[model samples]
Target: MVAPPPIIVLAFFCGTSIARSASPGPARPAKPAPIAADARHKQLTFRNRPRVVRSGRMRRMNMSTSQPGTEIGYTWPIRVYYEDTDAGGIVFYANYLKFFERARTEWLRACGVDQHRLAEENDAIFIVRSTAVDYRAPARLDDIVKIISRIERLGRASVDFVQEAWREGTLLATGSVRIGCVDRATLRPAAIPPSVLAALRHGPGTSESAD
Candidate 1:
Protein backbone atom coordinates (compact mmCIF):
# COMPACT_ATOMS: atom_id res chain seq x y z
CA MET A 1 0.00 0.00 0.00
CA VAL A 2 1.20 3.53 -0.67
CA ALA A 3 2.47 5.27 2.48
CA PRO A 4 -0.13 7.68 3.88
CA PRO A 5 0.82 11.23 4.82
CA PRO A 6 2.04 11.46 8.45
CA ILE A 7 -0.26 14.46 9.13
CA ILE A 8 -3.29 12.56 7.67
CA VAL A 9 -2.49 9.46 9.76
CA LEU A 10 -2.01 11.59 12.91
CA ALA A 11 -5.25 13.47 12.23
CA PHE A 12 -7.17 10.17 11.70
CA PHE A 13 -5.78 8.75 15.00
CA CYS A 14 -6.61 12.02 16.82
CA GLY A 15 -10.14 12.03 15.34
CA THR A 16 -10.75 8.41 16.42
CA SER A 17 -9.50 9.17 19.93
CA ILE A 18 -11.73 12.26 20.15
CA ALA A 19 -14.77 10.30 18.89
CA ARG A 20 -14.15 7.53 21.40
CA SER A 21 -13.74 10.04 24.23
CA ALA A 22 -16.86 12.00 23.18
CA SER A 23 -19.11 8.99 22.52
CA PRO A 24 -20.98 8.24 25.69
CA GLY A 25 -19.80 4.96 27.29
CA PRO A 26 -22.94 3.24 28.53
CA ALA A 27 -24.83 6.39 29.46
CA ARG A 28 -25.25 6.75 33.24
CA PRO A 29 -28.88 6.48 34.19
CA ALA A 30 -30.44 9.82 35.14
CA LYS A 31 -30.84 10.22 38.86
CA PRO A 32 -34.45 10.43 39.91
CA ALA A 33 -35.62 13.83 41.11
CA PRO A 34 -35.34 14.23 44.87
CA ILE A 35 -38.78 13.81 46.40
CA ALA A 36 -40.09 16.91 48.12
CA ALA A 37 -40.56 16.66 51.87
CA ASP A 38 -44.34 17.08 51.64
CA ALA A 39 -44.53 14.59 48.78
CA ARG A 40 -42.52 12.08 50.76
CA HIS A 41 -44.78 12.57 53.76
CA LYS A 42 -47.86 11.97 51.64
CA GLN A 43 -46.35 8.90 50.00
CA LEU A 44 -45.46 7.49 53.39
CA THR A 45 -48.95 8.16 54.69
CA PHE A 46 -50.53 6.42 51.71
CA ARG A 47 -48.19 3.48 51.99
CA ASN A 48 -48.93 3.02 55.68
CA ARG A 49 -52.67 3.34 55.22
CA PRO A 50 -54.63 0.61 56.97
CA ARG A 51 -55.98 -2.32 54.98
CA VAL A 52 -59.76 -2.17 54.60
CA VAL A 53 -62.29 -4.94 53.96
CA ARG A 54 -65.80 -4.35 52.69
CA SER A 55 -68.56 -6.59 54.01
CA GLY A 56 -72.32 -6.58 53.72
CA ARG A 57 -72.92 -4.65 56.91
CA MET A 58 -70.11 -2.10 56.65
CA ARG A 59 -66.44 -1.65 55.91
CA ARG A 60 -63.80 -2.84 58.34
CA MET A 61 -60.11 -1.94 58.38
CA ASN A 62 -57.38 -3.86 60.13
CA MET A 63 -55.09 -1.68 62.24
CA SER A 64 -51.86 -2.30 64.06
CA THR A 65 -52.87 -4.60 66.89
CA SER A 66 -49.33 -4.18 68.11
CA GLN A 67 -49.59 -0.55 69.21
CA PRO A 68 -48.42 -0.58 72.78
CA GLY A 69 -50.90 0.66 75.40
CA THR A 70 -53.64 0.66 72.78
CA GLU A 71 -56.42 -1.80 73.47
CA ILE A 72 -57.38 -3.99 70.53
CA GLY A 73 -61.03 -3.16 69.99
CA TYR A 74 -63.73 -2.75 67.41
CA THR A 75 -62.61 -0.46 64.60
CA TRP A 76 -64.68 1.53 62.13
CA PRO A 77 -63.33 3.18 59.03
CA ILE A 78 -64.54 6.61 57.98
CA ARG A 79 -63.69 8.45 54.78
CA VAL A 80 -63.36 12.19 55.20
CA TYR A 81 -65.62 14.04 52.82
CA TYR A 82 -65.69 17.72 51.90
CA GLU A 83 -68.64 18.19 54.22
CA ASP A 84 -66.60 16.72 57.07
CA THR A 85 -63.87 19.30 56.47
CA ASP A 86 -63.61 22.98 57.10
CA ALA A 87 -62.42 25.79 54.82
CA GLY A 88 -58.87 24.74 55.66
CA GLY A 89 -59.62 21.39 53.96
CA ILE A 90 -58.94 19.58 57.20
CA VAL A 91 -61.48 17.71 59.29
CA PHE A 92 -63.32 19.98 61.68
CA TYR A 93 -62.56 19.41 65.33
CA ALA A 94 -66.17 18.65 66.16
CA ASN A 95 -66.30 16.08 63.38
CA TYR A 96 -64.06 13.79 65.35
CA LEU A 97 -66.92 13.40 67.80
CA LYS A 98 -69.13 12.29 64.94
CA PHE A 99 -66.52 9.79 63.88
CA PHE A 100 -66.30 8.43 67.38
CA GLU A 101 -70.08 8.24 67.56
CA ARG A 102 -70.27 6.21 64.37
CA ALA A 103 -67.68 3.79 65.63
CA ARG A 104 -69.47 3.31 68.93
CA THR A 105 -72.75 2.85 67.12
CA GLU A 106 -71.24 0.21 64.91
CA TRP A 107 -69.72 -1.51 67.89
CA LEU A 108 -73.13 -1.64 69.49
CA ARG A 109 -74.64 -2.96 66.29
CA ALA A 110 -72.00 -5.65 66.11
CA CYS A 111 -73.02 -6.66 69.61
CA GLY A 112 -76.59 -7.01 68.32
CA VAL A 113 -77.87 -3.88 70.03
CA ASP A 114 -79.80 -1.86 67.49
CA GLN A 115 -80.60 1.55 68.87
CA HIS A 116 -83.80 1.90 66.88
CA ARG A 117 -84.97 -1.57 67.75
CA LEU A 118 -84.01 -1.07 71.35
CA ALA A 119 -85.97 2.14 71.48
CA GLU A 120 -89.06 0.59 69.92
CA GLU A 121 -88.99 -2.80 71.57
CA ASN A 122 -87.29 -2.06 74.86
CA ASP A 123 -88.29 1.62 75.13
CA ALA A 124 -84.63 2.42 75.69
CA ILE A 125 -82.07 4.60 73.95
CA PHE A 126 -78.51 5.66 74.41
CA ILE A 127 -77.54 9.28 74.92
CA VAL A 128 -74.15 10.79 75.24
CA ARG A 129 -74.00 12.33 78.69
CA SER A 130 -70.50 13.81 78.50
CA THR A 131 -67.44 13.73 76.28
CA ALA A 132 -63.83 14.84 76.60
CA VAL A 133 -61.61 14.99 73.54
CA ASP A 134 -57.97 15.94 73.02
CA TYR A 135 -56.91 16.87 69.53
CA ARG A 136 -53.41 15.83 68.60
CA ALA A 137 -53.37 16.21 64.82
CA PRO A 138 -55.64 17.17 61.97
CA ALA A 139 -57.12 14.89 59.29
CA ARG A 140 -57.63 16.22 55.78
CA LEU A 141 -60.21 15.56 53.14
CA ASP A 142 -59.99 12.19 51.32
CA ASP A 143 -58.14 10.74 54.26
CA ILE A 144 -59.26 7.47 55.76
CA VAL A 145 -59.91 7.93 59.47
CA LYS A 146 -60.02 4.86 61.68
CA ILE A 147 -62.00 5.10 64.88
CA ILE A 148 -61.19 2.57 67.56
CA SER A 149 -63.80 2.16 70.27
CA ARG A 150 -63.26 0.28 73.48
CA ILE A 151 -65.37 0.02 76.56
CA GLU A 152 -63.64 1.49 79.57
CA ARG A 153 -66.40 1.07 82.12
CA LEU A 154 -69.85 -0.41 82.37
CA GLY A 155 -72.46 0.96 84.72
CA ARG A 156 -75.99 -0.13 85.50
CA ALA A 157 -77.35 2.66 83.33
CA SER A 158 -74.26 4.05 81.68
CA VAL A 159 -71.19 2.94 79.73
CA ASP A 160 -67.95 4.81 79.25
CA PHE A 161 -66.02 4.41 76.00
CA VAL A 162 -62.47 5.31 75.11
CA GLN A 163 -62.40 6.17 71.48
CA GLU A 164 -59.51 7.24 69.30
CA ALA A 165 -59.26 8.68 65.80
CA TRP A 166 -56.29 7.64 63.74
CA ARG A 167 -54.91 8.20 60.26
CA GLU A 168 -52.45 5.60 59.15
CA GLY A 169 -50.47 5.08 62.35
CA THR A 170 -50.88 8.62 63.67
CA LEU A 171 -53.37 9.34 66.41
CA LEU A 172 -55.33 12.42 65.51
CA ALA A 173 -57.61 12.59 68.55
CA THR A 174 -58.55 10.74 71.71
CA GLY A 175 -61.91 10.89 73.45
CA SER A 176 -63.77 9.53 76.44
CA VAL A 177 -67.51 9.48 76.20
CA ARG A 178 -70.08 8.50 78.80
CA ILE A 179 -73.21 7.09 77.28
CA GLY A 180 -76.35 6.78 79.41
CA CYS A 181 -79.32 4.62 78.76
CA VAL A 182 -82.55 6.57 78.83
CA ASP A 183 -86.23 6.15 78.27
CA ARG A 184 -86.96 7.14 74.70
CA ALA A 185 -89.98 9.24 75.61
CA THR A 186 -88.83 10.89 78.83
CA LEU A 187 -85.13 11.04 77.95
CA ARG A 188 -84.46 10.26 81.60
CA PRO A 189 -81.87 7.79 82.76
CA ALA A 190 -83.12 4.20 82.86
CA ALA A 191 -81.57 0.92 83.87
CA ILE A 192 -79.87 -0.79 80.94
CA PRO A 193 -81.91 -3.82 79.94
CA PRO A 194 -80.61 -7.32 80.62
CA SER A 195 -79.95 -7.95 76.94
CA VAL A 196 -78.12 -4.65 76.45
CA LEU A 197 -76.12 -5.15 79.63
CA ALA A 198 -75.14 -8.61 78.51
CA ALA A 199 -74.11 -7.26 75.13
CA LEU A 200 -71.96 -4.57 76.70
CA ARG A 201 -70.33 -7.03 79.09
CA HIS A 202 -69.37 -9.30 76.20
CA GLY A 203 -68.38 -6.45 73.94
CA PRO A 204 -64.96 -6.52 72.31
CA GLY A 205 -62.12 -5.67 74.68
CA THR A 206 -64.48 -5.20 77.60
CA SER A 207 -64.32 -6.75 81.04
CA GLU A 208 -67.19 -7.70 83.33
CA SER A 209 -65.80 -5.32 85.91
CA ALA A 210 -65.64 -1.61 85.20
CA ASP A 211 -62.14 -0.38 84.46
Candidate 2:
Protein backbone atom coordinates (compact mmCIF):
# COMPACT_ATOMS: atom_id res chain seq x y z
CA MET A 1 0.00 0.00 0.00
CA VAL A 2 1.17 3.54 -0.78
CA ALA A 3 2.13 5.60 2.30
CA PRO A 4 -0.26 8.50 3.26
CA PRO A 5 0.95 12.04 2.36
CA PRO A 6 2.89 13.67 5.19
CA ILE A 7 1.09 17.07 4.83
CA ILE A 8 -2.45 15.54 5.03
CA VAL A 9 -1.47 13.43 8.04
CA LEU A 10 -0.18 16.45 9.99
CA ALA A 11 -3.42 18.54 9.38
CA PHE A 12 -5.65 15.84 10.85
CA PHE A 13 -4.69 16.73 14.45
CA CYS A 14 -5.93 20.37 14.01
CA GLY A 15 -9.26 19.39 12.28
CA THR A 16 -12.69 19.04 13.94
CA SER A 17 -13.17 16.17 16.46
CA ILE A 18 -15.85 13.41 16.23
CA ALA A 19 -19.50 14.47 16.43
CA ARG A 20 -20.09 11.96 19.26
CA SER A 21 -18.01 14.16 21.56
CA ALA A 22 -20.20 17.27 21.14
CA SER A 23 -22.18 18.59 24.13
CA PRO A 24 -25.82 19.68 24.13
CA GLY A 25 -27.05 23.01 25.49
CA PRO A 26 -28.68 23.14 28.89
CA ALA A 27 -32.47 22.85 29.11
CA ARG A 28 -34.71 25.71 30.23
CA PRO A 29 -37.47 25.34 32.82
CA ALA A 30 -41.06 26.46 32.27
CA LYS A 31 -42.30 29.64 33.88
CA PRO A 32 -45.13 29.45 36.42
CA ALA A 33 -48.34 31.46 36.32
CA PRO A 34 -49.56 33.86 38.98
CA ILE A 35 -51.85 32.30 41.60
CA ALA A 36 -55.27 33.60 42.59
CA ALA A 37 -58.08 32.43 44.87
CA ASP A 38 -61.15 30.90 43.22
CA ALA A 39 -64.30 32.96 42.66
CA ARG A 40 -66.25 31.47 45.58
CA HIS A 41 -63.60 32.34 48.09
CA LYS A 42 -63.61 35.88 46.80
CA GLN A 43 -66.11 36.16 49.63
CA LEU A 44 -64.62 33.42 51.80
CA THR A 45 -61.45 31.36 52.30
CA PHE A 46 -61.57 27.84 50.72
CA ARG A 47 -60.24 25.22 48.21
CA ASN A 48 -61.03 21.80 46.59
CA ARG A 49 -59.41 18.36 46.13
CA PRO A 50 -60.31 14.66 46.03
CA ARG A 51 -62.20 12.61 48.62
CA VAL A 52 -64.62 9.66 48.89
CA VAL A 53 -67.67 10.01 51.11
CA ARG A 54 -69.96 7.10 51.86
CA SER A 55 -73.10 9.22 51.61
CA GLY A 56 -72.37 10.14 48.01
CA ARG A 57 -73.37 13.67 48.98
CA MET A 58 -70.10 14.76 47.41
CA ARG A 59 -67.18 15.85 49.54
CA ARG A 60 -63.98 17.66 48.75
CA MET A 61 -61.26 15.11 48.05
CA ASN A 62 -59.67 16.32 51.19
CA MET A 63 -62.68 17.82 52.95
CA SER A 64 -65.92 16.91 54.71
CA THR A 65 -69.01 17.16 52.56
CA SER A 66 -72.75 17.28 53.20
CA GLN A 67 -74.61 14.01 53.63
CA PRO A 68 -77.74 13.43 51.63
CA GLY A 69 -80.71 15.74 52.43
CA THR A 70 -78.87 18.51 54.20
CA GLU A 71 -80.76 21.64 53.22
CA ILE A 72 -78.88 24.14 51.05
CA GLY A 73 -75.50 22.40 51.21
CA TYR A 74 -73.22 20.81 48.59
CA THR A 75 -69.72 19.39 48.02
CA TRP A 76 -67.37 19.11 45.05
CA PRO A 77 -64.15 17.18 44.43
CA ILE A 78 -60.90 18.66 43.15
CA ARG A 79 -57.50 17.24 42.20
CA VAL A 80 -54.27 19.15 42.54
CA TYR A 81 -51.75 19.38 39.71
CA TYR A 82 -48.29 20.92 39.44
CA GLU A 83 -49.93 24.14 38.30
CA ASP A 84 -51.57 24.39 41.74
CA THR A 85 -48.28 24.46 43.60
CA ASP A 86 -45.32 26.67 44.35
CA ALA A 87 -41.52 26.38 44.09
CA GLY A 88 -41.37 23.91 46.96
CA GLY A 89 -43.78 21.58 45.12
CA ILE A 90 -46.48 22.18 47.70
CA VAL A 91 -49.85 23.83 47.31
CA PHE A 92 -49.26 27.49 48.11
CA TYR A 93 -51.12 28.93 51.09
CA ALA A 94 -53.02 31.34 48.87
CA ASN A 95 -54.03 28.46 46.61
CA TYR A 96 -56.09 26.90 49.37
CA LEU A 97 -58.24 30.00 49.25
CA LYS A 98 -58.77 29.35 45.56
CA PHE A 99 -59.79 25.82 46.36
CA PHE A 100 -62.29 26.97 48.95
CA GLU A 101 -63.80 29.40 46.49
CA ARG A 102 -64.30 26.72 43.88
CA ALA A 103 -66.22 24.42 46.20
CA ARG A 104 -68.46 27.21 47.43
CA THR A 105 -69.12 28.51 43.93
CA GLU A 106 -70.21 25.07 42.85
CA TRP A 107 -72.34 24.89 45.96
CA LEU A 108 -73.98 28.14 44.97
CA ARG A 109 -74.49 26.82 41.48
CA ALA A 110 -76.09 23.84 43.12
CA CYS A 111 -78.33 26.36 44.88
CA GLY A 112 -79.27 27.89 41.52
CA VAL A 113 -77.67 31.17 42.41
CA ASP A 114 -76.36 32.86 39.29
CA GLN A 115 -74.07 35.58 40.56
CA HIS A 116 -73.68 37.27 37.20
CA ARG A 117 -77.37 37.25 36.44
CA LEU A 118 -78.24 38.32 39.94
CA ALA A 119 -75.93 41.27 39.62
CA GLU A 120 -77.44 42.22 36.28
CA GLU A 121 -81.09 41.89 37.14
CA ASN A 122 -81.18 42.63 40.84
CA ASP A 123 -78.25 45.06 40.76
CA ALA A 124 -76.84 43.10 43.68
CA ILE A 125 -73.88 40.79 44.21
CA PHE A 126 -72.48 38.98 47.17
CA ILE A 127 -69.30 40.16 48.81
CA VAL A 128 -67.13 38.48 51.36
CA ARG A 129 -67.87 40.11 54.66
CA SER A 130 -65.37 38.06 56.62
CA THR A 131 -63.33 34.85 56.42
CA ALA A 132 -61.39 32.93 59.06
CA VAL A 133 -59.12 30.11 57.88
CA ASP A 134 -56.87 27.70 59.78
CA TYR A 135 -54.18 25.68 58.04
CA ARG A 136 -54.13 22.24 59.64
CA ALA A 137 -51.61 20.38 57.47
CA PRO A 138 -49.43 21.27 54.53
CA ALA A 139 -50.64 20.05 51.12
CA ARG A 140 -48.12 19.12 48.42
CA LEU A 141 -48.17 20.09 44.77
CA ASP A 142 -49.90 16.94 43.57
CA ASP A 143 -51.90 16.29 46.71
CA ILE A 144 -55.59 15.77 46.13
CA VAL A 145 -57.76 17.99 48.31
CA LYS A 146 -61.44 17.95 49.15
CA ILE A 147 -63.43 21.09 49.93
CA ILE A 148 -66.63 20.81 51.90
CA SER A 149 -69.16 23.62 52.11
CA ARG A 150 -72.27 23.95 54.22
CA ILE A 151 -74.70 26.71 55.00
CA GLU A 152 -74.29 27.43 58.66
CA ARG A 153 -76.75 30.28 58.48
CA LEU A 154 -78.68 32.26 55.93
CA GLY A 155 -80.00 35.69 56.78
CA ARG A 156 -82.07 38.13 54.76
CA ALA A 157 -78.96 39.69 53.26
CA SER A 158 -76.12 37.31 54.02
CA VAL A 159 -75.04 33.67 54.23
CA ASP A 160 -72.63 32.00 56.60
CA PHE A 161 -70.65 28.94 55.59
CA VAL A 162 -68.50 26.35 57.26
CA GLN A 163 -65.86 25.26 54.79
CA GLU A 164 -63.07 22.74 55.16
CA ALA A 165 -60.20 21.28 53.14
CA TRP A 166 -58.92 17.75 53.41
CA ARG A 167 -56.16 15.56 52.01
CA GLU A 168 -55.87 11.79 52.32
CA GLY A 169 -58.83 11.86 54.70
CA THR A 170 -57.09 14.36 56.94
CA LEU A 171 -58.10 17.89 57.63
CA LEU A 172 -55.79 20.28 55.83
CA ALA A 173 -57.54 23.54 56.46
CA THR A 174 -60.79 24.94 57.81
CA GLY A 175 -62.52 28.28 57.53
CA SER A 176 -65.71 30.13 58.33
CA VAL A 177 -67.05 32.40 55.65
CA ARG A 178 -69.62 35.21 55.73
CA ILE A 179 -70.90 36.79 52.53
CA GLY A 180 -73.39 39.62 52.23
CA CYS A 181 -75.53 40.88 49.40
CA VAL A 182 -74.40 44.30 48.19
CA ASP A 183 -75.68 46.68 45.57
CA ARG A 184 -73.49 46.47 42.49
CA ALA A 185 -73.13 50.23 42.16
CA THR A 186 -72.96 51.40 45.77
CA LEU A 187 -71.39 48.29 47.16
CA ARG A 188 -73.73 48.83 50.07
CA PRO A 189 -75.64 46.17 51.94
CA ALA A 190 -78.70 44.84 50.11
CA ALA A 191 -81.28 42.22 50.92
CA ILE A 192 -80.88 38.83 49.23
CA PRO A 193 -83.50 38.15 46.60
CA PRO A 194 -86.48 36.04 47.62
CA SER A 195 -85.94 33.62 44.71
CA VAL A 196 -82.29 33.16 45.57
CA LEU A 197 -83.20 32.75 49.20
CA ALA A 198 -85.72 30.05 48.30
CA ALA A 199 -83.08 28.18 46.34
CA LEU A 200 -80.75 28.44 49.29
CA ARG A 201 -83.47 26.96 51.51
CA HIS A 202 -83.51 23.90 49.26
CA GLY A 203 -80.41 21.88 48.42
CA PRO A 204 -79.49 21.40 44.74
CA GLY A 205 -82.00 19.22 42.92
CA THR A 206 -81.09 15.66 41.94
CA SER A 207 -77.44 16.51 42.70
CA GLU A 208 -77.19 17.52 39.07
CA SER A 209 -76.97 21.34 39.36
CA ALA A 210 -73.65 23.11 39.88
CA ASP A 211 -72.58 26.65 40.57
- Which lDDT values do the candidates have, in the order given? 0.83, 0.72
Per-residue alpha-carbon lDDT of candidate 2 for residues 43-82, written as tens digits (9 for 90 to 100): 3443354454464552322223444334234557789888
- In the predicted model 1, the residue pairs found to clash are none
lDDT of 1 by residue, 1-211 (tens): 9899999999999999999999878878899999999999999999999997555852122222327345467888999999999988899999898898889988998898888889999899999987878898999989998888877778899887778887888888888888999999999999999988988888785744453
lDDT score of residue 59 within candidate 1: 19
lDDT of 2 at 113: 85
Stretches of candidate 2 exceeding 4 Å from the true structure: 1-73, 204-211
Q: In candidate 1, what residue range of length 10 has the lowest lDDT sum?
A: 57-66
Displacement of residue 24 (Cα, Å) in model 2 is 98
Candidate 2 local lDDT, residue 206 = 22
* Deviation from native of the Cα of residue 178 in model 1, angstroms: 0.3
**Which stretches in model 1 have alpha-carbon errors above 4 Å?**
1-71, 207-211
Worst 10 residues of 2 by lDDT: 58-67
- Once model 1 is optimally superposed onto the true structure by TM-score, how far is the C-alpha of residue 151 displaced, in angstroms? 0.4
